[model samples]
Every structure is written in C-alpha cells, then in structure tokens.
Target: MGPSTSAPRPRSCGAPSAGVMIPHKTKRGEAALARLKTYEGVPPPYDKTKRLVIPDALKVLRLQPGHKYCLLGELSKEVGWNYHDTIRELEEKRKEKAKVAYERRKQLAKLRLKAEATAEEKLGSQLDILTPIKY
Candidate 1:
C-alpha cells in the first residue's frame, strides 16, 4: 500500500503557548470564529471619550492590560475591524460571565445551607408510638 500524504491541521494560532493550558476549542468556539470572520466590515463613527467602537474579532482576542495609546477602536480601523462586532462580543462575554457567577452563587448557597443543618435535622424528627400488649 502507498503511504498516505496529507497536510497536518493547523493549531489555533492566538492561544497561549505556556502558562495555563486552555484546550483548543473544537465546536462551541465555532460561533466566535464565525463572528471573527464576519467582523471585516466597517463600524460607525464613535466618540473617543465615551464609546470606543472596535470590530468583533479584535474584541474577542484577549487584550493587554493598559496603555497610554489612543482609543483601540480607531486603531482597529487600520487593522480592518469595526464596532458593531465589538459590541456583539462584549454582550456575549457579559452574559456568559453573569451566568457563571449566578450558578456559582447558587452552588455555594446550597452547600452552606446543607452544612448548617444538624444530623438529626437532616434526618428529620423522631416520633414515639405507644403499643398496648394483651396478656
């Protein structure tokens, strides 16, 4: 049999090479990818002081902490990203984080309440029944 020749699949480029190991997303991340691809369109004009609009792809990528640089939205224009996609990404992350926080709170509350109960309380109260025996 002839040896099969095929090109190796390319791993996600932007993912970190060291530190925390975030596995390559296979399916759920597809939506984000699609959004990233669609973010090539231009975003509307935005005031630098208030709302800095950027394209969706740039927003999805993890950004550096701080810089004295100009509003990133303006810079993103040169890179071909726009603002509406940026808003979409922000909304997605906001909802995702809120849901996770809510679930975590619910779990912690459940654990704390369960721990506060005594063994007897957890088992329920005991009731005595009297039976008469005939001789």
Candidate 2:
C-alpha cells in the first residue's frame, strides 16, 4: 500500500466542563453568577447594540503551531446536544412568521382595491341620476 491519505484528527481534551467559568470566591459572587441567565440567540433588547468580540477567544489567535483543536460547539455535539436540529427548528419558525405576515399584507391589499372600486361605482351612479337626459 502507498502513503495514508486520511486527514489527522483533533486530540481529545477529556470531559467537558459545565457552567460559566467565572471566578467566584465569596458566597455573594457565587449567587450573582447563579442568578445570571444565559440566552441562546441575541435578545430583542440587544438586537440594535453592537456585538463584542474577545480577541483571545478568536480561532486564529488561540491556535498553536502544528496543533489541531476542536471548537466548543463540536464538543457540545459529541456530548449529545443537537445544535443543527435546534438551528433548523428556529429557521422554520422564522420562515413561518414571514409567510404569515406576507399573507396578511396580501389580504389587506385585496380589501383596499375592492373598497376603491365600490366607491367609484357609487359616484358614477349618483352623477347619472343628477344629469337630465336630452330627448
């Protein structure tokens, strides 16, 4: 056989750690960390705000020479979290919402056109009645 053509796999880093990695020495700090809620996507309140990026957490900056590393998302998938499925579900919901809004706008436009046609017919009839016919 010739040389192996398979790509090198990332090194296993053992079991994943749970919860946020905040330094909490005091009881109050622990309580505050516990009280903080984590959101999956950006919330409506922060939608307009600019997102902050940590330079240290960036892939290019954190990567070492000749070392392969697996991302946290990849590790989560190995732990049985269906990240792709969740994203698919969210996309479906968003499409459904847009479809419903489009349908509502179509119905409103139809109603508006019908109302305009009825008004024009009523005005034409009144004008015919007011004008006298030449014998």
Candidate 3:
C-alpha cells in the first residue's frame, strides 16, 4: 500500500474550546433533575405576574444559570408554546388577563363580522348577468 488516502478521524478528547463548559451536577442537583424530569410540559411554574419563576425553576430543574435561556428555548420548541398560549396558560388563574383576552377576542370578532358585511354589500351591489347595459 502507498500513502494512506483516508482522512484521519477527529479526536473526541480534544481540549475545551473558549466557551464555558456545562457545570457538573451536584448530588442535590441530580435529585432535582430527577424530580423535574417527571413533568411532561412547561417545566416551571409561573409567578403571579405571568412570568416564569426562573431561579426556582432552574434550581428545581438542576440547571445552571447559564443554561436557563437555552433550556427555555428548547422547552418551547418541544412543547410548541406560542406567545398567546404561553401567556394564557401562565395567567390562567388570573382573572385580569382572562378578561383582557376576552375583550380582545370580542373586538376581533366584531372586526371580522364588519369585514364580512362589507364584502356581502359589495357583492350585492354588483349587477347580475342579463341586466340591461347603460348607454
């Protein structure tokens, strides 16, 4: 055989890159992760202001502070919680947000009805076939 033509395999045990490494879990963190993993969706409980309880969530989830943003992003992707759904779910227990959402929904319904009525009026005004043509 002449010189080897195949490229060398990349090293798995390479030195760390410039970015910070993931923190190793402590005993408590391991236990917390186990507990948090039991849930199916939206890992944390929301606070009264309809925001996620980040610190508490991370602590319970056994995630480092640096990983919070990424965790939430992945969770949203996996759970498919859009803005309105998230807001509604987070504030589900709050009457104020529910009332606000109800008012917005009513306004949207009125707008849709008005649009439909306008479209019907325009269609009605159009001359039907066989009508006498104006000179």
Best lDDT among the predictions, by candidate number: 2
Candidate 1: global Cα-lDDT?
Answer: 0.45
Identify the runs in model 2 with alpha carbons over 4 angstroms from their true place. Answer: 1-20, 88-135
Instruction: Give the C-alpha miss distance for residue 115 in model 2, angstroms.
Output: 40
Error at 4, model 2, angstroms: 41
Give the candidate order by descending TM-score. Answer: 2, 1, 3
Sliding window of 10 residues with minimal summed lDDT for model 3: 10-19
Which numbered prediction scores highest in TM-score against the true structure?
2
Candidate lDDT (C-alpha), each: 0.45, 0.59, 0.47
Per-residue lDDT, model 3, residue 114, is 100
- Better model by TM-score: candidate 1 vs candidate 3: 1
Q: List model 2 lDDT by residue over 1-135, tens digit each.
A: 135533221122222122235556678767766666544433456543545799988877878878977665456456554554675566577667667877998999999999978877887867576558523
Tell me how far the alpha carbon of residue 81 in candidate 3 is from the true structure, in angstroms, after superposition.
32
Model 1, stretches more than 4 Å misplaced? Answer: 1-81, 119-135
Error of 3 at 51 (Å): 20
Better of 1 and 3 by lDDT: 3
Clashes of 1: 2
lDDT digits (tens) for residues 35-126 of candidate 3: 43223223345322344456754665676557644444344445433453554455464666557877998999999999978876776756
Q: Tell me the lDDT of model 2 at 80.
A: 53
Q: Would you list the clashing residue pairs of candidate 3?
A: none
lDDT score of model 3? 0.47
